[model samples]
Target: MKKSLIAVNSVAGAALLTLVAGAAILLVLMFSTDGDADADRRAFFGSLMFSTKEQADGSTAITAGVDDPVPLIVLFVVLAIALTFIQLTYRALKVHRQRLLEERGLA
Candidate 1:
């Protein structure tokens, strides 16, 4: 039961990683600029990175990151969870390796 649960989790994690990668690729492609014709469409995607718009007073209003922010927030949440599991896996392997070495009186 425990083994099956682990197997399922591993598969789920892999699927999620693939999903995230696809999402990232889609975001990039959406932001891609072909030429000057895409300048208008690039506003939103550009804002995800950076932008500087001139104000009425001849001052520049600089901004960065997504204005909606939901996408960015969701992306961070997914990455954080993936990182947590990665760290847990690394620690577990290290501990298991140390335990095995100690068992054989090698450490």
Candidate 2:
């Protein structure tokens, strides 16, 4: 049972790490701007479904529908905290079980 619990925890941790890493990579990509003139400026906006184009002046003429990042950040933080709590709880449970076995002269 303990071995199975450890295996499950390992898999969960790996999956969480993969998700966090992917999100981090995506966030980095979102913030990164390449210094290429030929780079399609419309691509980014198009990905976000933005249809308005910039005028001769230096101001945005169109508003695009987009999801706010604040809520996503908050959700990620909450998930990270929850995963940490689960890991700590698993460790504590394993330790407690070991101590119990020792106390009963089973180990």
Among all candidates shown, the one with the greatest TM-score = 1
Q: Report the lDDT tens digits of candidate 2 across residue range 1-107.
A: 76566556655665676456545544544445343221222222233322334466754454333334444445456665666667768789999999999999999
lDDT of 1: 0.57
Evaluate all candidate structures by whole-model CA lDDT and list the values in order: 0.57, 0.53
* Residue 101 in candidate 1, Cα distance off native in Å: 0.4
Task: State the lDDT of candidate 1 residue by residue for 7-93, as single tens digits.
Answer: 566556655764565456446645564432312232323325434456678765644444455554465566656755775687699
Q: Judging by lDDT against the true structure, name the best candidate.
A: 1
TM-score of 2: 0.42
Measured against the true structure, the TM-scores of the candidates, in listed sequence, are 0.47, 0.42
Error of 2 at 99 (Å): 0.2
TM-score of 1: 0.47
